[model samples]
Target: MFQQKSYQTQVSGTLYLVPTPIGNLDDMTLRSCKLLKECDLIASEDTRNTQKLLNHIDSQVPQMSLHEHNYRERVPQLIKLLKDGKTIAQVSDAGMPSISDPGHELVVACIQEQIPVVAVPGPTAGLTALIASGLTPQPHYFYGFLPRKKKKQVEELQKLADQVATLIFYESPYRVAATLEAMRMVFGGERQVVICRELTKIHEEYIRGSIDELCEYLQETVLKGECCLLVAGKLEEEPILAEYSLEDGLEMIATRVAAGTKATKAIKEVAKETGLSRQELYSAYHQEE
Candidate 1:
């Protein structure tokens, strides 16, 4: 049986997951602005950064830091405050909370503890760039950041090489060139790629070309601002590979698990694509002991 929580009745002691603008301040919605002002306390990823936003919106709401380091200590405190009937607004440094940012842990705890967690959708770098990317927008896969290690990053990309949907990734401006080189190596030099930088800000720019062309351009041009990389999906001439192997499914699950996806979820996704029995795949995958 499916369980449901009626969020409409969630008025008090609520956890509001608010999204701040990614780059431009004007993109901040009126509703989010009002909610932040009225929420009892603001749980900010970076209190200083969020303070600047509060300043921009003319809000004087009190804030407490809830970032990567302190979230473990803070989640329980926030839950207690929520139970005591204090509404809170959670904001990341930019864009949405918990999407390539902190707050996932807190959200999980809230759901487990029966606290209302309402997400206030506003902006995200991935979807913002994807819409204008000119690639296959639908069925896109959003992989926030690639693995930092060279070998692991290659392995992760190689595992996703066969995906037919446009691939969206978030990258730092400093590392984007190296990331492009990695893409060139894995997805080939001819794959189409678009990099949206300083999104919605004054100096916003979209650098678009084949992987090789962009790599050559970045050599001469210095890219600034946070970046979103959108790459066209693999174009397989054949609809299906006749020789699809079970080993391929296993590797996919392994990579997903290594990337922090739960084993059962990884198995379920891979199983759907591979037409393997869910129970059998789960057994085979968990048998790694």
Candidate 2:
């Protein structure tokens, strides 16, 4: 727990979290460019990829690779530099750092050491695609990338099946189709989904439709570049029994039990679907018998 007055004069060096352009170079902010220019060192997720951006901006700042594979090893070295009063700027390959990118550990280290951590906001892929996808903007959940394994991915989707906020996910081009198929299976075919590909680039495209439609389209078309998927939230509605009478509810529960559902489980399910009390349903069902 520390208080940070970012602009105030301090004894130690600063750790700047700078956001780079997601695709278009023009999206890079002037402050971000200036910070990159002034910082003593630039810790990049991918030095080669970042070099191109630096070259484009004509910045000659020296950089070191700091990615998932080497972040732990490099964190202590970076902290030492900060302790010695040398400013460092952290950047990802694209978009914002630590949003499905590296930089979280370094930031945590800086905070623990009471180093001044300054953030210069710029572009982010998730929010960039979200607004353009025509989904609910305010209440959104950004799940950067799902698990790569099929079963794990399905399990994760099941966890978010009942979320009432717009769901966002990042996926590679090769897995986009399969991920869409998995989502359709978990969320139902009619659920609305938006696929944003090659965002902010010349060939950027958005495919918006029901999950079933998108799944079919993906089967025929091969997508290029990374993708951001936006899915509509679960519909909030009255319970199934809102319009049904007690007799109707009882009949539904009986049918489910007849179809091999345990009697107790069927009653509980009916109670949940109808928004009725489980104890009340049990009593009523027993009384009717």
Candidate 3:
């Protein structure tokens, strides 16, 4: 419920959520570079990996590890620094911070403490793959990294079975084949799917086909690097009644009644099955032939 006018002057130091390149160093934003260089401290998912980016940008800002193992412990310490008016910038190894990466907990802590938090937009693998996926772009659901266990993965997919929005998921190269097979089982083999690998790097590839086709293709072709899987949503089709002529519907009603079902019951059953209005069926049933 708090308003964050990031540029406004404030007593507390700001927390900047900077996005690093997913693969190519060229994708790094100018604002991201400036913030990383200017911030008092850089909290990184992996200091060693971040050092590479820092070296590329010529930034020697001090960094401390704030990954999954220590994010919980580090939140309080970062929050204290912010309160003491020391600006802190958080970055994952690649892509945006706190998005399938570390920094979500710290951002929450900052908000609770009424600290200013600013996010600089940059490249992300999911959206990058999605535009090239040739699927509907507007309505999309990004589910980053499914559960590793087979049973749990199946359970999660079952919940999304009826989702009408395009689905996006991140997967490791090693598990991409198995995950595609599981998706084919839950979402059916005919559903269109795209597998984007290595993102902006030189080896970047987008493999597009039906779920079953991709499942077969991956068995022979080995893949490396982070993968983004985009699946088309279930197609919305008109009800069966759209295909049923009045004569065909009436014949179905007559058949059901002749099978010892009452006339009213037959009309109701046929109406329900064909998605026709009960009154429409009744009127047609009573109308002269």
Candidate 4:
């Protein structure tokens, strides 16, 4: 005689990191709509903002607020629900959640609690700006925003002044003019720059020229909408070998070491700046010391 066996099944809840449209409603992915409709609950940066989106897709799934103001407090509660075996979908006002927006804190908490999180990728303003800028794409750095303080912003620009890759930065309408002026000073007036404004919206516009030229052009226009600033990399210059003695290299190495640069990095930077081989410079530096 055989007895029937009863198996206890464990339900594991999931957290879906959903991406909303950066601008146009057409940018929303079909998968995103399906996920939003099917999830047990949708956690939104703004329930009101998400309501319209849900209305568009004819979804009425339960929605809750999870934004910058309340994310810290709400994450724990959301995690507990997940623990209780309810699937949760997280969405920002626009674009990917927790990018330069909401959801990071909650996502990190979910990770710590071993909750499953999946990304439903879609529209992104940063990327859209980069691609449409028509600059070299492979090697570009995305700077989400410039420092509010002029001095700090200048310092950041100086650090990347010599970078050979294109640079992308986001700016607000109010600061767009000043940001471009700062970029012109650090990167020089001759460098090509593209200013994308109100991307994916009806008022979308692209202002392309040298930094100085663009600044002049923008001065006459009333800037409106979101901004993405793209600047070309510094022109590649041939390495100029400075007249550096072995003693000088050793002294430079000591200074860099004091500034917390590793011996290997100091050697490479010194070689690049002074135009010398790593092995030859290392050997000569040792000989002089």
- Candidates in order have lDDT scores of 0.88, 0.91, 0.91, 0.85
Instruction: Mark the regions of model 1 whose C-alpha exceeds 4 Å error after superposition.
Output: 1-7, 10-12, 238-289
lDDT of 4 at 260: 97
Candidates 1 and 3 compared by TM-score, better number: 3
Candidate with better lDDT, 2 vs 4: 2
57-131 in candidate 2: lDDT tens per residue? 999999999998998899999999999999999999998888999889999999999999988888988888999
TM-score of each: 0.80, 0.83, 0.84, 0.77
The TM-score obtained by model 2 is 0.83
Least lDDT summed over 10 consecutive residues: which range in candidate 2? 238-247
Tens-place lDDT per residue, model 4, 27-121, is: 88989999999999999999999999999999989998998899778988899999998989999998888878878998788778767777877
Clashing residue pairs for model 4:
98-102
- What is the overall TM-score of model 3 with all chains considered together? 0.84
- Identify the candidate with maximal TM-score: 3
Model 3 residue 95 CA deviation (Å) reads 0.2
lDDT of 3: 0.91
